[model samples]
Target: MRRPIEFKLRRRTLLAASAASAVAVGFARRGVAQEATAAARPAGPETSTVTLTINGRERELTLDNRVTLLDALREHLHLTGTKKGCDHGQCGACTCTVNGERVNSCLSLAVMHDGDEVQTIEGIGSPDAMDPMQEAFVEYDGFQCGYCTPGQINSAKSVLEEINAGIPSHVTDDLTAEIAVTDAEIRERMSGNICRCGAYSNILAAITQVAEERS
Candidate 1:
């Protein structure tokens, strides 16, 4: 009887085959992952260039479209006076004047206001020369922690402007008639701003003093 030919596989060959298979599988997975990542990537310029007239000065900035006006001011411009509280447009800590009107900066996108005018707390006053509203706030102790003082002062100024401009608020009794700067009017207009320090009474007093002085 003819002896049967026996074939044996080398351990080194088996190990090399296993390693090659693992390498091939790894390359396949890497290629798939790269394709998925490329597909998920967003197309277009992620940043936009906008020119804003902030505090009576022209400022040109190239910023991400997703950045809010508040972030643009506080982060890019280095104006930290506009506080970022809540960041949901609920707390008015990020309030600022855009085209002479008070707006929640957090709610506005920087790219949307390409050629808009903005006024922040820094524009309102300075340490050496404070605005009348700022002075009143100091006199009446309108703030405790002072976190919301900048927004409070900004809103207070706009409140008077709104009343003077005949913009009727919710509490206005007569829309056709001239609006009065009553407590209700002030409260209704200022309801958007939230003061966690519970200094509403003092804030009211401060605003009232400014109103009276202007009147």
Candidate 2:
């Protein structure tokens, strides 16, 4: 009788120990999950304010960190002249002059160009007073759909500057002498800008006209 009673008491003790172990494990798991949740929480707001000297004017804008320069121009500043073609750097439709250099605006973040100079299509010209490149594009009928015209014009202007500045490209013939604005140089430099309307000839003509006038 005594042995049976002791056996039952030992069984009860084992069962209680098992229950205690399960409770301890559950509490530990809960604590771990809570810690993970806390760690995953954001520490602060992911927004920042930046000032851009756009089109000869200082414009202050507060934008999200992830917002691209293209979006800031189109969405925030309402400068829709810079089109968002591929939203990638491949299309070059969102090309704009940043600090006198043409850059794919879609690939650049707005926060990155704090206090930097930006020139969009609107800044380049208006209906009445058009820049020389804009005039050339219109005169030569350099565009069919005009979707990529803004970027094309922007890039074209920069191409002339690049050549005159003696910036050697792949097709630059003489490295020691002055760089001439040849068809090959213009074509190679403007290769980044794509016109889906197949107006390559017209664009080339427009660029050549501008180059001749400048020379």
> Which candidate number would show the highest lDDT if scored against the true structure?
2
lDDT agreement with native, every candidate: 0.93, 0.95
Clash statistics: count for each candidate? 0, 0
Overall local distance difference test of candidate 2: 0.95
Per-residue lDDT of 21-66 in model 1, one digit per residue for the tens?
Answer: 9999999999999999999998976999999999999999999899
Model 2 residue 2 distance off true place after TM-score fit, in angstroms: 20
Clashing pairs in 1: none
Question: Could you tell me the TM-score of candidate 2?
Answer: 0.84
lDDT tens digits, residue span 69-169, model 2? 99999999999999999998997899999999999999999999999999999999998999999999999999999999999999999999999899999
**What's the TM-score of each model vs. the native?**
0.85, 0.84
Runs of candidate 1 with Cα error greater than 4 angstroms are: 1-33, 42-45
